[model samples]
Target: MELDVHKPTILVTGGAGYIGSNAAFLLSQQGYQVVIIDNFKHGQQFYPDWARVIKCDFSDQSILDQIFTHYNVEAVMHFAGLIEVGASVRDPKIFYEENVVKVLKLLNKMQEHGIDKFVFSSSAAVYGTPTKVPIVEEHPCNPINPYGNTKYAVECMLSDFSRAYGLNFVALRYFNAAGADVENGLGERHKPETHVIPLLLEAAQSGETFSIFGNDYQTPDGTCIRDYLHVKDLASAHYKALKFLDGNKSAVFNLGTGIGASVSELVNMVTKQTGLSINVEVKKRRSGDPDRLVADPSRASTLLGWKPEYSSLETIIADAWLFYQKPDAVLYYSDQSYQQSSVF
Candidate 1:
């Protein structure tokens, strides 16, 4: 198979989804050719024009072989996987198949094609029920649920692959990924949206009562505290991880703001942003929820030179509100026009 060596190409596995789409756009802006493959199960039909979209599941080995045969894929940013913790708990089979088994197949194909660099979209869920606050990468990975187990399983697989096959990888274990690409008209649009930010926005806009599960946790406000990082910062970390892989090394980094915000604080932020008093109903805490899951992002900051630029509670809510208000806005790729102006 002939390869285009002039333009380095990145194959984004779930480039049509929320974080993946933004990563695709950022890669394109940084002058890398992007080829996106998504099943459209949880992703959207819209994407940047520069990216080549291939509608197929990552488990399809034949299709993957064809893609590797056609393009000179320099590296891969894998974001395609199931994320619902509750759903994973109910039916662990699908999570294993989609998240673990499919990813193994994709890695095998990458080995066949000699493409080694990988950036895995992992989760803070891997460090389930953290024994310490400001969780670090070395925290014991005792995932409390199947969704997190799948991610930890993949991280183990990546480690073995790197040791045996010389494949370099970076596993970014992210906390709550919130906010939207307001300039590009990209945001969270999950089928039954479960994220707190979007759910609160929906409740505020529609005057519906939103549920805050288990407010009597061991927190200052008796609510769960999570480290919310902006989607754009998460995307930038992917680009940085790709560059870091150029040194033929494997690493794990936590992606977050290192700041914890409780559920009550988030609700207050949304109310302030939208000027609508949101109604809330506190319920029993969901199973497998930790009281605090903030990140110690010093590793990512020191190594990748990446930090959360738009991760404040106020900015997160404001960006999400803009996207919620303009869901159908046209998305364009303009590097200079979309500069990070302070939203706070």
Candidate 2:
């Protein structure tokens, strides 16, 4: 299915998170009418100032009515939900309530309102430790934790709804979303930083020690390896998916760099880029992390024409370093900026 692409009204849910806000910026630049909804659990500022941003949860029907009435929301890009993997295990109910139940409610409201097109922000975590390497979109989903389970469940619901309600959707499964909008003005910032790239940047800024979770993986470097994709490329994928769904058909795609970098390998890259030494600490393995989680993004390439551009180890570390020094970058990440030497 293809779209007119001349103009479209896009309502972006969770448009305040790392990927959501970036995606919103790209949509606006592409001449799409953009509306954003966020709960601010992970505060995002500078929401493409051009976009109409609403500060509230979409699970609330009242706000939904207002948003629907205000914007000619022809399509929706769903990104609002809890994302902590470990925490999900402790509070599976919250994960279900927030990720699964809230989505169901949102979909119900969309159906009632006759809003059918949707683009979901799904995760590759649904694959867990795959039995095969370079896992494809067709790989069996055997989520090891509640976070992954919730995303998988949502995908299931989307499939169910597409058949039963004629709801057109494109569910994007993300492999590790890293880096930022290199040529644009958006970047990654998360409070209590958990993502690897940002944490490494923070440690370099503060001269603090960075932890390497379980350095005994089966890789050559003996540290966990993950497939890291630049967020800029990812946001593009969302926009393309939106157009794809608007064609009145349903599809799914994976956004990844098609390459994996080990934990030690990433540290080495950061060290090379910033010339800052980071102390490394190895801890026990995180419960749900697979030793390796690289993606086979061939399906997306053949389907959505999506590919990551800045995921090369050098550019990924450098973009994160630039955001570490910017103020707007602080809103999404922590407020503290690492001391800089005015020269990179």
TM-scores of the candidates are 0.94, 0.91
- The candidate maximizing TM-score is 1
RMSD of 2: 7.2
Candidate topping lDDT: 1
Model 2 per-residue lDDT tens digits across residues 58-137: 67787777566655678888998988887898899989999999999999888888889999999998887799888888
Q: Give residue 342's lDDT in candidate 2 (0 to 100).
A: 17
How big is the positional error of residue 294 in model 2, measured in Å on the Cα after superposition? Answer: 0.5
